[model samples]
Target: MDLSGKVAIITGSGRGLGLAYGKELARNGAAVVINDIDRASADGAVAEIVAAGGRAVAVVTPVGTSEAAGELVATAVETFGRLDVLVTNAGILRDKVVWKMTDEDFDAVIDVHLRGTFTCVREAVLRFREQGGGGRIICIGSPAGQRGNFGQTNYSAAKAGIVGMVRTWAMELQRAGITVNAVCPVAATAMTETIPFLAPHIESMKRGEPLPAIIRRDVGMGTPEDAAGVIAFLASDAAADITGQALSIGGDRLALWSHPQLTATDFHDGGWSAEDIAACWGQTFAGSIESVGEEFPEEVMPK
Candidate 1:
């Protein structure tokens, strides 16, 4: 997919996954706008892209703030004359269980992941609509959000919110030809390294230990490049009809996420009393939920 003449903005594009996306998109002919909170990182990425014969510019701005988000899109338009795609890849992690998670930790994560995504998309979607066409919005989600994790209550909740944003925006912006989607990329970045409790797993990774088998193949561990390909594809015209969807991009595997399947259906229409809700919760949380006579195989076990 040639993105020639298209103007694309990728948040957090200093290094890691964001940088990978910016590099690939620029190579594919898009006039890439690299956004990062750190000016040096953003400029460095732009330099690399330019050195490679690709067109790119760097803009350092906080994605979580409304003013900064607007400036990010404005920078693209001012530099490239129009906006075509937005990749919301900026985020932070505060790993803590719900009870132990402080309000600041929760807010920081939510502001960066959820609010930042909304800010960027909201600005880009308007430009797209004004240009008399739809545009693509690809958010960076996570498996932690889809399947609850031990100490990622904040991260998981923020990411889960991104999925909800995609679904809602897809419905609200489809009329204007806008397409909203998200990709849960599993790249080992600074965030992963900073999770203190993951040191053992990091050491294991260094030792080339493999993850459990039952998880989807494509959902296996991956590098930034693995996720970049999907981000680039979704931003291209080839994925025009695809919206309101979340995908898992890991390794050589790419799978459509069935995030909702993890949650069982509820039959009641009206609100249930507290006792009724307690009873339902008790039953739901009671025991194993695997298919009848089908035990969870070792292959599908968690890491």
Candidate 2:
């Protein structure tokens, strides 16, 4: 946790989870580079860090672009002298179902989440390699990437792509002493406040519209601080051996983020027919429904 003279660049550090991370890193002795599109918030964050006896500078730039990412990295090296840790925490949500989703929505989300991570990490990787040592690249991901949400197709795809990018980058950069990882964070912010619109719809429900009670239970739940601890760990020396892993931080839980595991997979290996695929789907659904136990009962949805 003693970052000391290490230079860290955090995207979207003006507010929410990114702000929390900047505060923590600065307090711990790292000279931080705070990046955000909003000049005011970015300046305010750096000022707070300075007021608290932490060295930091604010950079106003759009991280979704490669040029901006390079500029951000250059600012860190030029101002503080070296780049050591990078936390790509900038993102936006443009939620919509597949059919209702616009290309703009999909593009924007991917540009900010997936492409932004790529741009920033690629820029930092060069410095890490040139220095002939290890560095940390922490990308922000989401639970929607692990478990699909109804109206978050764009966000989910972008987040999932982030995990893929981290995994690939980890292997590609391992020899260069650079480690890449991801954190699937759940925070209470502007993004979560829109969840009422993202909640799943059940057409088969005889009750027609989804009840207000069910919707209320599922949205806007975790706090920004909940995500900071995990990001801090990934950005720390303690996590040096851990790379290409996706960890989830939400509420009171911290665990590895993973995809669904099937009882039997690889139907393609044996060349399954249509009937085999249909039967597999039927068994999987039945088993899954029963496995949920009381977690997903009919009364919750009300037939």
Candidate 3:
């Protein structure tokens, strides 16, 4: 899709998936603002994009703070004339079991992922309204959030919260011509390389080698470009009617996630006592209740 004359901002865009998104958007003719906490990394991204004959500017600012987020939005407008898209991809991970997770760890992840996304979207929407045009807001989500993973309580909560924000904003801003969506991407990035079992495969992929059969079967190996393509599509005009969606992208796979909804319910005219409720609980709810690990069925997962 042609994004000529469009102005877009991508957070944490100095490296990883964010960098890939910025490059792709810029390559598509968008004037991109690269936001990152590291000045050198941000400058490097801008230099690379410019070297490739794409327009891009670096804005070294952390995303969680209101002032910084506002500045990021302001920079895009000042430098590029107007803003058209805001991609919230800045995030951190502090993995630990619930019991071992400290308040600091929990708060840090939430601050960067959830709060940061909120601030950036809020700021961008204000500009979008003033500009009197529709805009796109793409929030980054994680599989850990959709289905809880081991030792990632903080990360999961923050990512899940992002999906909620996307849904709420999508409804609230529909009339304003603003679309909000979330994407859960599985790719071989700096973050995925941390997984012990996936490290060797990730390294091999980096060296342009094929992944092992077992690793390829269990978790399809994909690069940041795989995820960037999906995000770019969501920002294009073709996706104007598609909002409030939680989409997954990995390898050649694309899937839509179902939102939470009522599965089974027991109704009592007055109110059932503890013993009365217990009597029908097994038949009404027990059969539908899923056991641990059932979420990832053996049929779909690695044998």
Candidate 4:
């Protein structure tokens, strides 16, 4: 996808998937703004992009705060003269089962993933309106959120909330030529290194070896570049008509997720009694009530 004159701000782009996205966009001729909390990493990314003959600037700021998010957009506009894409890829993970999860864990994850995405998108929308042109908002999501993970209540909830934001903003911003979408990627990155099942493969890749066919086939393991391709496509003008979608991308796999809707219903005159509802519950919904993590066996699951 060509993004010749576009200016994009990719949060958490100091390294990993966000850095991959910035590099991909820059490679495709878009001016990039790399935002990260780590100053050295952000500067390193900018230096690499510039050395490769791409235009980029590093913005060292935490994305979890409104002021920082606003500064991110302002930096893009001031440096590049216009903003065309905003990728909310900044996030943190704090994993624990509900009972063991602390308030700090839950709040931190939510603040960086959900609230940070909101703040960045809000600022980008304001700039897009001022420019009087279309824009793109690409939010990062995860498979854990789509199918709840065993010990990631906070992380899953935050990612799920991002999809909700995507759908709502897509509708609210369509008239303004803004397309909002989320990419649910399962790539081998620093984030996925925490998964025991994927850690070995990530290490193997880091050592410049090809992953085993079984691991690649089963889990669609690949580098961050694999996911960045999808994000770049969504940021292009070619995807102007596609909005409010949760597209899953990993290696050679790509899939679209279905929105939640009522699958079955039982109705009485006004409302049914508790006893009546309980009597019909099994027949009406039991078969359709899906179990989580049925696709992966227990032995293969991350501990």
Best by TM-score: 4
Better of 2 and 3 by lDDT: 3
In model 3, how large is the Cα lDDT of residue 105? Answer: 95
Off by over 4 Å in 3: 212-221, 291-303
What tens-digit string does per-residue lDDT give for candidate 2 at 1-303?
A: 777888899999999889988888887788999999999999999998999999999899887888998899999989999999999999888877799999899999889888898889989998888887789999888777766677888888888889888889999988887889988876556676565432333221223553343333433224576667767677788888999999877556577855445654444567879887786776655555423111333434434
Candidate 1, residue 96: how far the Cα is off, in Å = 2.0
**Residue-wise lDDT of candidate 4 within 115-213, one digit each (tens)?**
999999999999999998889999999888888887899899998899999999999999999999999988888788888777877898989998766
The CA lDDT at 121 in model 2 is 91
What would the C-alpha RMSD of candidate 4 be, to one decimal place? Answer: 1.7
User: Which clashing pairs does model 2 show?
Assistant: none
On lDDT, the candidate that comes out on top is: 4
| Candidate numbers, best lDDT first, in rank order | 4, 3, 1, 2
In model 1, what lDDT does residue 15 have?
Answer: 94
Model 1 agreement with the true structure over 15-111: per-residue lDDT tens digits: 9999999999988899999988888998899999999999898888878888988898898999999999999999877887779999999899899
Off by over 4 Å in 2: 197-221, 259-262, 266-270, 276-303
In candidate 3, how many Å is residue 130 off? Answer: 0.5
Q: Write down the TM-score of every candidate.
A: 0.83, 0.83, 0.93, 0.95
Kindly report which residue pairs in candidate 4 clash with one another.
none
